[model samples]
Target: MAGPLQRVLMRSAASAMHRAKASEWHYGPGFDPQKAAAQYEALTMLVLASGAEIEWLTDADDGLADSVFTHDPSLMTDHGAIILAMGKALRRAEPGLHEAAYRRMEVPILGRIEHPGQVEGGDCVWVDSRTLAVGRGVRT
Candidate 1:
């Protein structure tokens, strides 16, 4: 028994896997682009699970350590979002930029994290619709 909706969803999943396999960038001995591309595909799985069809203001700039200075699109909830202050020095800019994107998304900012405390997207896990388990990374 296969409904059209279920069939479409299944197709989307299979296509995603195919694209991940087709990605040719590979990380090498010193540093590898292929490996990096593969990692990016893995991380995109998380983004795909958001459940909310939201838009993104991608920085696409890789100068920062995390390259996400303030792209906290995760804060876009039905109620509001709490702006996260990142712990990484290079990505401290991420929160402010996140604020701007949230503004464009028209989502309300319920609160924010102060300095001396930082959040990294790579260390965050959205376990459920309303729950998240975020970890800290080693500071340089």
Candidate 2:
């Protein structure tokens, strides 16, 4: 059975979420900023939500040592790998690190995309063997 306090908490949480608008709620239930993050961190909600894993600006490895434009491989093949040069300065070093790793593995270089056209790693997705899409996510 649901307790009275649990019912009240549900109502309060619902009200807070409703008032903030569906897409506009960065803060969580209680409508308080300080504790808002805590409600959002609850396990029940996160498990049900769609996760977007972005290693970008990874606190540990920002991929700076690699290159400013590094991205995941197009395809991880047994023979070797393909390194892509990103269009943006924000990712200039990532590809180089990937290149070094491939070098250690004794893989061959497949060629890269040069400047003028900018691409963000966030905008990349592997569609299939014949297709790889690169979208400029933060394009102005």
Candidate 3:
């Protein structure tokens, strides 16, 4: 059997789609809020089905449209979470919001990536307990 999931972090599509056009990550012609909401609901159901305790972030009016992809702001590890400093200038506000949520949940914070070092959580992958592979690219 699969090991039990400890926790998961997710932001609502309602918050994300409200300002989709302003998002730097979306290149599509236009965003349909209804479709986004449906997709988000489906994804949440899947996470719940996997038996992970989900933490939903409802504060969406921060003008961070890309917030729905929570994987970009922080990376979780066995030791703790590393709050990333996103390479995208528009996304700089994300990590602080995630940090507050983590603090509320009592999740330990290992450290944070400072200004000079730009690291998006989406660019880093944990190969194993002692190995982490990070991509060095425009968005990393």
Candidate 4:
């Protein structure tokens, strides 16, 4: 899915990412929370400068270190958002967070991939408005 950034859903790094357990999250020894936060701030500023509207997800220390990756939890479409089920076991709760954000933002829910049908937004490639190609693998 390639398009101009008009609106985006983002979670700040102030929560889980700030206190991410490097071993659990598979982050390398080079991982630094402060640097990550600074980079996030820079990116946020860029997104704002681009005139895009950002809908932020609430930050909380829920031990979901990977929660800051909002894109993988849901897929946005012209109609509504498709709540995705994560392939990664640690990210299972992430979809619920996105769902809650959508409800708060008044964004409609098109459908969701159930327990047995796991799908990650990153593995989905939209060829057009209606054409979608889904890849299946370890991370799908």
Best by TM-score: 4
lDDT of 4 by residue, 1-140 (tens): 56778998888886668778787788899999888888888988999999999998878777777887777899999989999999899899999999999999999999999988888988888887789888888877
Q: Give the range of the ten consecutive residues with the poorest summed lDDT in model 2.
A: 1-10
The parts of candidate 3 lying over 4 Å away from their true place are 1-4, 22-25
Cα TM-score of candidate 2:
0.39
Error of 1 at 24 (Å): 24
Instruction: Record all residue pairs in model 3 with backbone atoms less than 3 Å apart, i.e. clashing.
Output: none
What digit string (tens of lDDT, one per residue) describes model 1 on residues 1-140?
Answer: 11111100111222222223222222123443345446655545655664424344443443332332223323433476677766545456656656776687677899876767555554665666567676656621
Candidate number that wins on TM-score, 2 or 4: 4
lDDT of 3: 0.82
Query: Which scores higher on lDDT, 2 or 4?
Result: 4
User: Which 10 residues in a row give candidate 3 its minimum summed lDDT?
Assistant: 22-31
1 or 2: which has the higher TM-score? Answer: 1
State how far residue 50 of model 1 sits from its true place (Å): 9.9
The global C-alpha lDDT for each of the candidates, from Candidate 1 onward, is: 0.46, 0.40, 0.82, 0.86
Compute each candidate's TM-score over C-alphas. Answer: 0.50, 0.39, 0.89, 0.93
Off by over 4 Å in 2: 1-80, 87-90
